[model samples]
Target: MKAKQIRLATRPNGMPTYETFKWTEETVADPAQGEVVLKSLYASVDPYMRGRMNDRKSYVEPYEVGEVIAGGVIAEVVMTNSTQFEVGDIVIGNLGWATHQIAHEDSLRKIDPSKGPLTNHLGILGMPGITAYFGLLDIGKPAAGETVVVSGAAGAVGTVVGQIAKIVGAKVVGIAGTEEKISYLKHELQFDEVVNYKSENFQEELKAACADGVDVYYDNVGGTVSDAVLRLINKYARIPVCGQIALYNLEKPDLGVRVQPNLLVNSALMKGFIVSDYGAHFEEAITDLAKWLKEGKLQSKETVLEGFEKLPEAFLGLFKGDNIGKYLVKIAEPSE
Candidate 1:
């Protein structure tokens, strides 16, 4: 059989362009023993993928030029050789930007579409969800009635981070790029306060919204926005540095604003975390998140792109803050 795939054609200097990727079709072999062939249903586009574009040493290796881009995918088994799975079983796995992939039985996890939208397996119910869960609870540690602030609040991880803070009884405030997104955060997500960082008086507005001082600041888009929030953090406050989207595409470090002295004066605690570091708690977090979702305490939003060819476009939008909630690409239909 033949499968269509998107491959990295070159290393991007800053923002990736269409020339950076090349789409090709190739013949795929059938599944061997203990392996299955998956027809992809949904693929995730996340900020972390940007880090993987550059050929540099990091926690995860970068995608080599001329190689397929790696990402989380929801797929259906069309052929299998393992007793653990059968044809027609829907599963989630770390497959790349491809229309079809072959994986070992152990590489896939069964999915229940009845639990929620199957695409969510690549969004809220997936790695981004786990990132928000562990980053907020374990690192931020919001206390009841305390204030929790999140940057990139309209994006996937930030959206869940704010809602989860509210679930823990903390007053939540969100910072997003557009007014429409700010409204979504306030009206749809029910955040206590929402600020449009693009506004002229963002710093003043943030201070007014967080009168008591931020107790927990979920730093997703770290830069000047993070610097401003840091200055207002109360004593012993916690900052979970989940992502630095603002700095991801930059060729050099942003200069002119320094907030380290404020942290020193406030005795605040700031920590960086990778969700994979807390893999031991994945099942526990997912179990609780599923319950919250079922009981109406948690909600997820997804900006889905149809077709596998749009993966690069979906990914490029992340740096521009162009997506609300989780950004995902639906590649195929979920099997019954």
Candidate 2:
């Protein structure tokens, strides 16, 4: 079968443009023993992918120039030589940006559609949801009645973080870029306070909204936004550092306000972590997230762009704050 893949054409010094991606079409090889041929149904676009574009050492290896960009993908098995799966089995894996590709049985996890929507595997039930789960609960640990603030609060991770905080009985405060996001967080997600970071009086509004002081700060977008949140932290505040989308595209290093002093003075716990750090506890997190979702204690939102060709645009939309929640590209409908 002919398959299409998107490769990294060039690495960008700052924000990536259309020139960064190179599209190619090639024939897919037949599945070998213990392998399955996958037809992608959906793909995830996240802020963390920005760090992988650079040729630098990170928790995960960088995507080499001219190599296919890989991330969480939900697909349906079209052909299989593996005993573990049969044709029409839906699976999720860290696969390439291809319409179809071959993957080993061990590398793919079959999806139980009874749990939730297939797209949930790429969003709330998958990476972004699991990310918010461990980061906020394990690290931040927001207690009942305590104030929890989340930056980029309307995006994938941030939205889940805020909802989870509310589930635990915390007063959730969200900081997003647009009015639509602010309204959604405040009205739909029931966040106690939602501040627009782009507002001219952002710091003032944030201060007013977080009048009780922040007990837990889920830092997703670092930079001046974090600088302000740090100032309002209460004694013994907990901070879980997730993504730094604000500084990811900068050509030069951001010399923002040093965070050490606030952490020192407030006796705050600030730790940065990637989702893989808690790989051993993924099942635990997923179970709780799935339960909350089923109970209506947690809400999942997605911004989907139709077609495989929209992958790059959906990815770039993440940095532009064009999405209200998880951004996804729907490539095709499952043949089953």
TM-score of each: 0.97, 0.99
lDDT of 1 by residue, 75-125 (tens): 888988889898899988888789988899887899986888887777777
Residue 123 in model 2: lDDT:
86
For candidate 2, report its TM-score: 0.99
The digit string of per-residue lDDT tens for model 2 on 1-336 reads 999999999998999998999999999999899999999999999888889999999888999999999999999999999999999999999999999999999999989988889888888888899999999999999999999999999999999999999989999999999999999999999999999999999999999999899999999999999999999999999999998999999999999988898889998999999999999999998899999988999888999999999999998988888998899999999994
Score candidate 1 by lDDT: 0.89
lDDT agreement with native, every candidate: 0.89, 0.93
Clashing pairs in 1: none
Model 1 stretches astray by more than 4 angstroms: none
What lDDT score goes with residue 275 in model 2? 93
